[model samples]
Target: MRYEVWAPSASQVTLHADGRAYPMRREDGGWWRRAAPGTDGTRYGFALDDGPALPDPRARRLPDGPDGLAAVLDPTLSVWRHDWPGRPLPGAVLYELHVGTFTRTGTFEAAAEHLPHLAQLGVTHIELMPVCPFPGTHGWGYDGVAPWAVHEPYGGPGGLVRFVDAAHALGLGVVLDVVHNHLGPSGNHLPAFGPYFTDRHHTPWGAAVNLGEPEVRAYFTNSALAWLRDYRLDGLRLDAIHALTPRAPFLPELSSAVDELSQSLSRPLFLIAESDLNDPLTTTPRSSGGHGLHAQWNDDFHHALHTALTGESQGYYADFAADPAQALAKILRGGFFHDGTYSSFRNRPHGHPLNPSTTPPYRLLAYTQTHDQIGNRAQGDRLSAHLSPGLLACAAALTLCSPFTPMLFMGEEWGARTPWQYFTDHPDPALAEAVRTGRRREFAAHGWPSDAIPDPQSPETRLRSCLDWDEPKREPHARLLAWYRRLIALRRATPALTDPDWSYTALSTDDRTVHFRRGPVHLAVNLSPQPAALALGGTAAIVAAWSPVAPPDGAGVLHLPPETAAVLLAT
Candidate 1:
């Protein structure tokens, strides 16, 4: 077998495999290679300039975690039981889940047992949070050091293979979230191997990954393809593309490569970027000189809707809180609220306007809450913790009934009571203390008492984030779940709800209510504390509603209870 590594800075390279060491010869493009008698399950690592051996930068399986030696395993060797066609993004209802806390056992095998529940929930795709190897057994999976390998604690590569196969059998597509901007602080050995990162640009984590180099770009691109091709994943959700300050046009290049692979496989493979730039170019076609990603997370819509429902005016929520209804109305008509507008949070003009005629609304993924929105909070409390069942149903109605592609965070369908807190497991005591201190200090600066903030390093914090399966079987929770089921069913059944056209969409708002129309379907949400009598443009029949909605009056006005939403079909 041939062993290879990229260590341009090293004068000497050695391949340590299967308890034997062999000198490697320098190859072109800053790579070192050597042939050895080894097969699958062979332990391997690379030593640079007589230094300690490090795991392969692109190791497919890290059997002993990121700090341990990598195992040589053929990914194609895994057997797939089901044949999956593919699921596209146009009309998909995405459900994002974290593998560790998704089930009681926190393993891929255990998570697979709940696939039937998601299929029944009417979500077309399950977006799994990063499963790459991190420091410990539990985490949000964002600070993963190995961008290519699966976390062994979550069943490694084979476990993910089995999980995807099971999901395919249930007619569900799986999308994995990937982090390429920066790796975790501890156990990251990429810099030692080569100039994978550069000090030319820095992100929140530190030096950015060097994407200008041809070989470095290939490293990340190949890792993404391996996940989709080898694991049979439908797509990938890129975490924070805005943080990446690549001197080269990496997004466009990545998209082109992915498109070529999608053609070869004859499947609908795609990429979704988590960007706050509010740039339509992120989703525009490559031929039009755009990045050509299939879709992006619409944080503008989330902020507007969140502030409206919760009356929050802190930090980024300040701008949206001024006039909640108007904010929601603007996002409904166009795709973004910031569209070349001044942002009070940033104190600058942010985002470019998107043409409704040129850009389809479905290119934006809208959600009520996300991992960052929930987990990063002081207490990691979900909206369900404070909002009533009626209000939660209202949020469901607006998102599902909107023109954009809707996504649900795990346990949102049933309003899972457990909090999805920020938790980490770093074996290093000093690193753990630093994380604990930083988390508390950040929240404390924002007026939250330090004691009120959960310790990210505490084991109890991770346990508190697990979803309670029994919650869905109880009152209010069961009712909310039923509401989500009906809303999703209606979206699938009603052509107007899933319509991608933005020109056909219209919105109107009063002091306490926001109304929008998608073709013949009109949705009105009452945001006030008192009952609202919203004027429908024409005579309509109540199709779906969060609470008991009174019939339209003689003048075509519907009386909706406070904190309620109704979807009406024009007669």
Candidate 2:
């Protein structure tokens, strides 16, 4: 219940609480400590020396929005009647969603209306994209300035609390995506206080957050802990950890801090890092001389799968277009394409050697399509707009049945036609224009035409990104929805499809179909125009297939309909 304010620039600091101000003693390294209203849930802010009162960088609970007073919330407060033993993280199916577009009202309470639907979809965990306060109402949330405060439009802190509490009550774990690499451009006023960033360590966005600086580390780490400590969040989906450069002792410091914080938390606090560097040390245990992060986003698996399905070999996808079965084999068993293989895109060998015995297969989170894959496009179009239904189903089946954990974008389940584009509502006119201009140029480097790019500043872009709530009830949308439900149900029910062994899984592809086998699961996908005969795995049991052909094949010889997927089992 105590409050700590890091304001090195200010000479004197006072606790603005209970409609009265009390002086706080300056503690270690410019931090002001006070024992004011530790028992009472009073709202407080740090009044600088003759300057305006500033919100605490490590504010536990915000009651009056980001610009308003901060509150000291006790965890024991407000009855938490729900009690159930915890479940392991390996078997979870995560559904990633943006709070702004998940509902019409877009508040946490509003999002609660869809709980039954999530439960029915077999979504074990719901990963909310960054809810931290940004410049305006809508965004992809990577540009978050006030990392401690929830976005006001999404009903602020109380709404987020309600959402998490509700999710737990429904037996759904909530993982909050947090941005620790850099703050947003417009409303980011952190540097006004002290050296929160350093020029020596620069990210793609301005100077990186000075994690090595005494107070800066406290600010960032404390902000991350707030969600788990106050919001009762189950895990932290760390964003762009490759950019989180700790100047001194980078690996152990950041990883140990996260590991320690997870241990200190009330419930199991899992940390999933979004890292591009395919280093095995990321998920390795601390005792084994590695960072103790629980898991990391598997972009290699995505790139491999994406290139194989679409055959659009450009940018990073250049390394993965040789064979469809390569992706099918790597993602199904080992988890990544760059498993010490020579990466032509990087012009050198990338990724360290992974220990099959030491490294757990579940340390990677895989997906065929996601918000980044959809939104990063010039037109903000989903894969459904580009690929055939059969190819799309092939990609979906691989993601769901793969050994590594699977995560779905908001509308990905039902094949929602509406796009999850990269949209931002930056109130500043100059900042908005800069963003639009920057985005266009960024895409141009990757061979995208300038004229084809959508302006990020335009209202049309944001409107286009909104989930068409009615897409679920329509023709192709309804069909895709049923397909996803059946696939997910099979994934949950079938033990063969859930096997996690990168080395053991095998794939064989010809002009006819792609054969994938992981343990007892055998998925034969017919990609040709004609009715391609599927050669099932020798040891696999017949569980299910997409019924690839029109009429069912008798004699226990499955007839795969054209462009359909057959999920089978080895008995």
Candidate 3:
């Protein structure tokens, strides 16, 4: 076996393997390495200048958590049962889930048991929220320290292999949500090794990654490739790329490296980014002077639909509250409601315009709920707890019928009532207290009561966030699940609904309603408090509806009840 790590700041480095210390030889570019035959479960850590041993930055498995020794296990040794020829971005329905809260066991093997349920829900892709190892135990996963190690509490590296293999067997592709902006405040050992982070730019979490440094860039790029090659992951969702400051060459460079790996693997791979910039160039090809990513999460769509349904008008929601119908219509027509527009919330101009004719609709991933949108709230209430059943169905109809690709938060399909609150298990008392205080302060700014915020260190907080799997088999939950299944089935059956060509899509809006046409399918949603009417020419049939009345006669008019959405197929 061979062991290596990049630790430029250290003059002497040693490998601690199974209670034995061996001096390591320093190699070029701040790397230290040693080769020796070892068994599969060999435990090791690197010691610098006779100090405490630290886990490997690229450790594949941390059986004892982040602060303990890294275990040696080859990914190729895992047995795979299927040869999945990955799915494409267009017309794909993505389901996002967190392993810890996704199942009662909160392990990868247990999560794999639910893959068939997602497949039955008509999900083509499964997007797992960060599985990288963090401190203590459970977390939201964005605060991960070891970028390459799987969370041990959730079954580590072998468990991930099993999960991916099971997903492939079910005809579902897996997209991992990876955080590269900054490491968590506690248990992060990257700084002690070399210049992995820089003070040149600061993000909301902390100092930005040293992306401008060649070695730092190489480290991340290699990690990205390992997910595709070693773990057999189909794609990656880059978390909050907007926070990656000095993004000039790094974004493009990372995209290029992934594209190369995708070609080499002979499998379709995608790179989706969670970007707040609303810049179309994030998905534009590198040859055209852009980042060359496949798609990006469209928060504009979420905000528009969220405000329209809940009528909440705080913070960024204030922008969409004034006219949600207009906001929805703008995104449906041009892919961004705030494109080059004044944002009163930010007190400045935000975003740039996108050409509907040139831009592909699949480049944008639309959703009504996400981890940040729900979990970041003071009470962490899901839309299911707030919105009416009809309104929830209405939101689903619009999301599935939209031209862009669609993603659903873990329990959104069945309207699970569990709140995905921000929970952490930091072992350090000071760090844990700071997290609790910071969470309360942040929500207090949004006018939420500080007393309502859950304690981050409490085990009950983590347990409360787990999904109620039995909910989907009963009452309104069953009905909502049926509605989602029907909408996804319609999306797959209707060619017009899956078309990515934005030029083929059109939109119109009034004070209480919004209507759009994608190919031969027309969608009309009424956001008013009372029944509304819209004109539709020619012969059309109601393909799907939420509290919809009978289709109007040849008089070319349709009436919809309050908060209703309808999809019609034109003959």
Candidate 4:
């Protein structure tokens, strides 16, 4: 087999495979290559001059870990069972799943067993969190070091292939969450090979990825494409594109490449970015001087809904707490609340206004909770921990019924009580201590007792985060799960719920109630602690409700219980 690596800074390079070293000849563009006697499953690494062998930056399989030797994986060896016709983003209900805590086994094979549950839950796509190899056996995966390799603990590349094949067999599309912003602090050796990161810009993790360099840019773009192509993935959720420097060429360039590949594959593949910039340009066309991504996570929507449901106004939640009904109304009508408005959290004007008339509502995803919202909390408590089942159903109704694409974090359908906490298994003791201390310090600054913060390095933290599957079989949880199913079925049945045009969406807010309408469908939500009356524009039939909601009277007034939501079909 041929061995290749990009070591622009190295004077001499050697390929170590099967306990033998072969000198690699330098080629153009700072690449080194040599043919080695190896085949599938061959363990190999590259040595720079007198330095130790380092894993390939583009390694396909790291069997042991990120620091371990890279193993060759022949993509042709695995056979797919389904010839999927492809699922698009227009009407997709995305479910964000973390492989580590998704199942007790924390492996792709085990997670695949639960696909039937998601399929029956009416979600169209399963958005798997990053499976990239990090320093430990388990993590949130944002700290991944090997961008191209799958975590060995989570069934590696082969297991992912099998899982995707299984999902395809069930007519479900799989999208992966990928972190390209910054490599983890530990077990990262990219700097030893070449200048993969530049000091011109800095992110929360320090030096930004060097997108100015041609090869470095290609490195990221190619990695994304390879996942979509090789693994037959339907799409990717790009993590933190706002952190990437020179976003113009890099994002547009990636979108162009992905578009070309999608055409070649004759599939509906796409890129969804997690950006806080609130810039519509993130989803604009390249010809129109925009990045041209398919969709992005709408944290504004989550924040508004969270504050309205829980009335928690800490941190960024403060921006939406003053009048959550108005904030939610703005998001339902337009797309963002901080559209060039002052943000108390950032202490500055943040976000540009989105042209709702021009942009499709489906380009923005609506969710009540996500990994960051749940895991970053002091106790990693989910909404179920604080709110009653009626309110949980209300959140589900608003999100799944909104015109924007809807996404559900894992175990949310059944109101899973497991707290998705910040847990890591870094082998380095100092790094582990730093992570544990930092987590406690962050919550401590928020007035939480240091002892109240869970130890991130503890295995119990991860175990506590795992979904208790039995919850779905019990009371309130079972009822909430039924509500989720009914809401999704209603959305699937109603065209207005999945309508792409933002012009069709409108909302009106009262003191503690909101009446939202998209086309002929109306959603009335009462966030107050007491029962309230909401007036629909016209007489409507009650289609779905979290609590008992009477049909509108002659004046089109809907009586909704507090902390509940009801869907109405306008006549």
Candidate 5:
């Protein structure tokens, strides 16, 4: 087999395999190559001249974590079962999950056991958090070091293949979350090999990746393509594109490459980005002078819904709390609440206006709660812990009834009480200590007592975060699950609910009550502490209602209980 390593920073490179070193020929662009007698499962590392041996930059399998040698993996080894046609954006409902804590076993195969449950829950796609091998046994998967290696703790490469195959057999598409902004602090060896990162640009995590570099761009683009082609993944959820610097050609190039691959595969492959920039150009087509990404996480919609329900005004929630009704209205109608408006949290004018006619509503992924929203909190408490049952149902009604695509965090359907805290298992003592200290300090700034912050290095923290699994069958939990099922079923059956025509959508609010109209369907949510009533424009039938104190009267007047939400069909 011909082995190659990209070490533009080194003048001499060698391939070390099976206790033998072979001097490699340096080609243009600082790539070194050599032929070796190695098949699948061969352990190897690259040595720079007389320097210490380092794993491949694109190691596909790191059986012993990121600090060990790379294992050669053959992509054609796994057998695929189903011919998945892939789900489209308009009707897709995504369920985001972390494999490590998704089930009691925390392995890909163990997580696959629940695929039938998700399929039964009306989920069209299963979005797994980053599975790339990092320094730890378990984590949130954002701080991945080996971008190409399947996480060893989560059943490794073969396990992921099996999980994907199982999901396809159950008629569910898979989407992977990928981190390309920055590598983790531990087990990072890219700097020793090449200029994979740059000190010229700084991100919240650390030095931003050297995305403008041709070789570096190719590395990430290829990784994105491999997931879609090799793993048979239907889509990729790019983590935090707003963090990348010199983002012009890098974002567009990545999008163009993936689009090309999707066409070539004759399948519906998608590229979704998580961004805080609130810029419409992130999802705009490349032909129209935009990046051409298919979709983006609409945090504005999440914040608006969250603030309206929980009355949370801390941090970025302050922006949405200023006028939550208006914010929700803007997001539902135009896809952004702070479009070119002054943001007190950002301390500047944030976001660009999106033309409702040109931008599709499905390009925005709306959610009431996600890993970051729940896990980043001091206690990692879900909205169910704070809001009343009625309010929680209200939040769900707004999220599912909106024109944008809807996503639910794992265990969110039944309002799982487990705290999805940030936990890691870095073997290095110093790195682990740093993580523990940093988490405490970060939350302290948000007014949380240092002692109240959970230690991210604690194994108990991870253990406590596992889903109860029994919660879904209990009262209130079971009811919430049924509500979610009904919402999803209604969305599938009603053409108006699934329609992406934002122009046909309208929003109206009065005090604590907000009314949204999408085609023939109308959603009314009361955020007030007391009961409220709104006059229906015309005769309507109640499609769904939670904790409804009073139904529509003979005069076509709808009465809602405190923190209640109702879905009505225009008659």
Candidate 6:
């Protein structure tokens, strides 16, 4: 196959083949090279006579820096044995993990050790934080430099293949989080070859990846399929897709392309959209004037649940904490916040009510704690520090017992003590300093003291974020683990919990207790510190409790102790 690098501004381009550097022809206003016999592994780098040497635009397997010689890699050689397909639907439990912090090794091989514990949690899917190669070893994978290649430190492409194979062997499905918006500044060498990004659109990170031009559009779809076909990824969690808006027509062609590819693949592929638009169209079918996604992260639910549980009102949390009982009730039953009401955040009326009767409930992924809520904090402290034990149990129940696909962040199950701090190991000194300054500026808007913000580039930041394997084996941590294990067991036992019909469930809450009704199962949660009498929607048979004490067994008033939760079946 012939290789081409786009350095349109270069006066002369040289393709270093083997030991010889041969000047390439400027065909069609770009550099071109044809491989000779036995040239599959021939390493080549582009020498722009005017500018410094840059990496190949389509370098799939980069063992070295961007300036290192790029070679043509055959993707067919990698033997994938992930024969089993992913989860069927709401039947699956998901665990969201950060590649860098999952283990101290921070490589794919090191992460393999925890796959067994995940299986014990009855987890069916493992959602890996972005694997796209970034500058350094530490990051949430949001700032990816190479959208296609796996990060080298995290075992690169080969280690990833082994990780996936191992996960499937343990009967777990793997979903990859991919950032299609902006590239991290450090190791990004794409612009040196082609106009992969457009000056028209810009996201919070930087200019959005170009999906307008024909070749650019093709590139993204190809990348999407490669994960499924080559890496054996079951699903693609589309990150910040709301930031992607097409030029004039306003038609979201990206969604259409994904759907088309999913159709052609003929496999059980899933697409989860992570959008805060609160627009049901994000998960709605394309025929219904929506972006045909399988399911999307429900931020409104998180906001309502977080504010209600923790009561920390700053920035976006301010608009939500006002009437959290009502906000959460709507999300619990309807799946969105605005539900045709006005939103103070956007200062406008927004969101259509989700048709719970017609719409499957699992389409919404609910979580009280996620990386955003934790890492975005002045200190990346988990909610374990903020809420009481009862409240923590309440939040986990709210997610797992609700009519949605529940997701648990890493270290959330046992109430991990270590905070998931934001850290970067960028090679570029200027970019590293810029990140620190940017973080300080962002937190200041939320009333956080600028000087108190931890440096995003510091070693202490990443070190603090690493999980302590011993923590789960001890104390209130052990108690927290037991609570989660029992809750997950109960959630799996009760078919009503995962039922798709939202209409079958009813919820009513006061300031002290939150009530959830699924068919005959009633979950009453006490958020207060003192014992209180709670009126049951109906008389219930006690099935489960978060604490050691059993709830009263009767068809009358149920009494609960401080920071307690109970699950019951109507007698």
- Please give, for residues 1-571, the per-residue lDDT of candidate 2 as tens digits: 4566777777888888867788888877877787766553577777888666666666555555455666666555544556634444677788998887786566778888888778877878999999887777777788877787778788777677777777878899988998888987766667766888999889999898887786677666667776776677778888988898763355456667766766665356678889888888888887887777788899988887777667778878888777756555655556667877888888998887677666667778988777787888777787787777777777777778777888988888777777766778888888888888898899888778988888777667776766777888887777767777777888888765555555555677764467766666777777665776654535445455544343224433456767777677665
Each candidate structure's count of clashing pairs = 0, 17, 0, 0, 0, 0
* Off by more than 4 A, model 3: 504-506
Give every collision pair in model 1.
none
Name the runs in model 4 displaced over 4 angstroms: 504-506
- Quote the positional error of residue 545 for candidate 6 in Å: 1.0
Instruction: Give per-residue CA lDDT, model 4, range 1-571, as digits (tens).
Output: 8899999989999999988999999999999999989878999999998789999999999998988899988988978888987899999999999999998789999999999999999999999999999988888999999989999999989999999999999989999999888998888889999989999999999898998888888999999999999999999999999999867688999999999999999999999999999998999877777888999999999999999888889889999999998898888878999999999999999999886655789999999999999988899999999888878888898899888999999999999988999999999999999998988888889999999999999999999999998889999888899999999999999998888777644578876788888888998888788999876768889888888877898998888888898988888
What TM-score does candidate 2 get on C-alpha atoms? 0.90
Report the Cα lDDT for residue 319, model 1.
82
| Model 4 TM-score on a 0 to 1 scale | 0.98
**Candidate 1: tens digits of C-alpha lDDT, residues 1-571:** 8889888899999889989999999989888999997778889999999999899998987899889999998865898999988998888999999989998689999999999999999999999999999998889998999988999999998999999999999999999999989998988999999888899999999999999887888898999999999999999999999987872488998999999999999999999999999998898888887898999999999998899889889999998989977888888888999999999999999999996655798889999999999998899999999998878888888899889999999999998889999999998899999999999899989999999999888889999999999999999899889889888998998998878778554578876788888788988888777998877868899988888888799998889999898888888
> What lDDT would each prediction earn against the true structure?
0.90, 0.74, 0.88, 0.91, 0.88, 0.77
Residue-level lDDT of model 6, residues 317-377, one tens digit each, is 7667787877888778788887777777778887788765446889989887888879988
Q: Once model 1 is optimally superposed onto the true structure by TM-score, how far is the C-alpha of residue 212 displaced, in angstroms?
A: 1.6
Encode model 3's per-residue lDDT on 470-543: one tens digit a residue. Answer: 99999789988998999999999998888767654457788778787777788888877799888876567898
Off by over 4 Å in 6: 1-14, 17-33, 37-42, 46-53, 79-82, 247-266, 549-553
Model 5's alpha-carbon lDDT is 0.88
TM-score of each: 0.98, 0.90, 0.97, 0.98, 0.98, 0.92
